[model samples]
Target: MTSTTDIKAIIRRHRTRDAAFAVLGMVCLLVCIATLMALLVDLAIDGVGRLSPGFLTSFPSRFPGKAGILSAWVGTILVMLVTALAAVPLGVAAGIYLEEYARKNWLTTIIEINIANLAGVPSIVYGLMALGLFVYQFHLGQSILTAGLTLALLILPIVIIATRESIRAIPGSIREAAYALGATKWQAIKHHVLPYSTGGILTGVIIGLSRAIGESAPLITIGALTFIAFLPPAPVQRTFPFVNFDWLASPFTVMPIQLFNWVSRPQQAFHLNAAAAGLVLMAMTLAMNGIAIYVRYHSRKRIKW
Candidate 1:
């Protein structure tokens, strides 16, 4: 019903709106990148000189310049090991069961909904829950085991969600082909499904672990000390068939906790230490993500379907 002039005007208006939106989006992106660059530059300038062997090797000290992150780094690694071991297999298995075996039932729906909801829950909430169940109810005390288990729980939902998405991305025809070759359901899933989805699964693991690594609230909530001065006892005491897990019960402090403690202090040197610790944590996270990306690239290249 519009006249030619009115139609042209409307077109011009639409074009203007679209251009405005495009500019806005670009501006937002640029702002984010600029802020990130500024932060990284500041961190580097503040912390680069502090990233010395002495800082890496020594235990944390009351004196800022003498402080090191050995105990913190070791505890972080140990806790991550426990978290990965506990979460990966169980989460992946649960994802497989939900995707491959679960029917379209109310229970399945409820579980899926709950998992999605849990993913959005605050990390601090997980900390409180861990504090109650693992710390108090289980009487695990403020130890590496309790902290690791809490993180495991915190990241489990992420793993399961990632696994499920990875599995779903595989074409159904692949499963049908495996079945037609006289493979059982379990065999089909084990061989065809898992092989194809390993890339996404690994990516998910890396992401979840990265999230766990940065987390402080849950660890703090579970009573992880911020200024741990000593390393946990070694897992192996004797050389003859040596293996012991007593160290799992030892008190722990991770990089994030250490960094938090440093940042909270009144000393300028402590702030610099925090920055260095931040760099280390950032490096670890980036390394994990890089490995995941490489794995995904190779996996996709090999998997044509």
Candidate 2:
């Protein structure tokens, strides 16, 4: 009878503790939501009125009223295009080689450790490295190409890590089954592994690109221009048979650089402009993350394994 009473007391204590933890978790989630809500509200109230067509189409000016995100946004798109092109293939390939092909050797272990360590390095360090390699050695000269390469280096570890984790999550049985079917290693990876892992790969890609979009430190470290009023020339010329690569070498400014310019200014108007730009940047990041979530959800749903 005493033991039964003790068991009941223990159950009561556990239930009480669980209930307290549940409430605490809810409180923490609510606080986070509340904070996000407050920020969005502040941004909307301060900047929503400024999101006009003219604001999207005009260039930066000495006067805040005339300043727009035209050059900034355009430069951002061009640089990101370069980064995605350069990083995605290399990152995915490296991940595949490490997870699928590499043996349990010391060199493989060293490479894995180095990649993990690289992921933690500051973005500014990548910028300095780019400043030496791309800017000085390669003589890319603070162009869009240089910035893209720098951002690519900054996010490569992230992509590789994400891809490796995604690939590792697949069951070993799947690989064995592929081998039993007389499939070569390359065929197995191409047909079975890649199809199943595409969702995860894309999720990683979007996440990396999102990070690339918001990075200011690396770009600034490589001497990205802060004040720019003119647009880079079009990638295509108006003349006959005209496809141009010249814009890749042109001077550029990204949105974050422009935002920094605004926030650093003494004028009240530029501060408002900064708020608007912040909203735009936040929207771009959220859009990419949303896409990643959707891809991951569908991928998990389709592949029960």
Most accurate candidate by TM-score:
1
TM-score of 1: 0.93
Report per-prediction Cα RMSD to one decimal: 2.1, 3.1
- The lDDT values for all models are 0.93, 0.92
The C-alpha stretches of model 2 lying farther than 4 A from their native spots are 1-28, 238-242
* Candidate 2 pairs with clashing backbones: none
Give each model's clash number.
Answer: 0, 0
Estimate candidate 1's alpha-carbon lDDT, on a 0 to 1 scale.
0.93
What is the per-residue lDDT of model 1 for residues 1-305, given as tens digits with 9 covering 90 to 100? 89999999999999999999999999999999999999899999999989999998989999888999999999999999899999999999999999999999999999999999999999999999999999999999899899889999999999999999999999999999999999999999999999899999999998999999999999998888887888898877777658778779999999999999999999899999999999999899889889888988887888887
Structural similarity to truth (TM-score) of each candidate? 0.93, 0.89
lDDT of 2 by residue, 207-302 (tens): 999999999988998899998888888988889768888889999999899899899999989988888888888999999999999999999899
**Whole-model lDDT, candidate 2?**
0.92
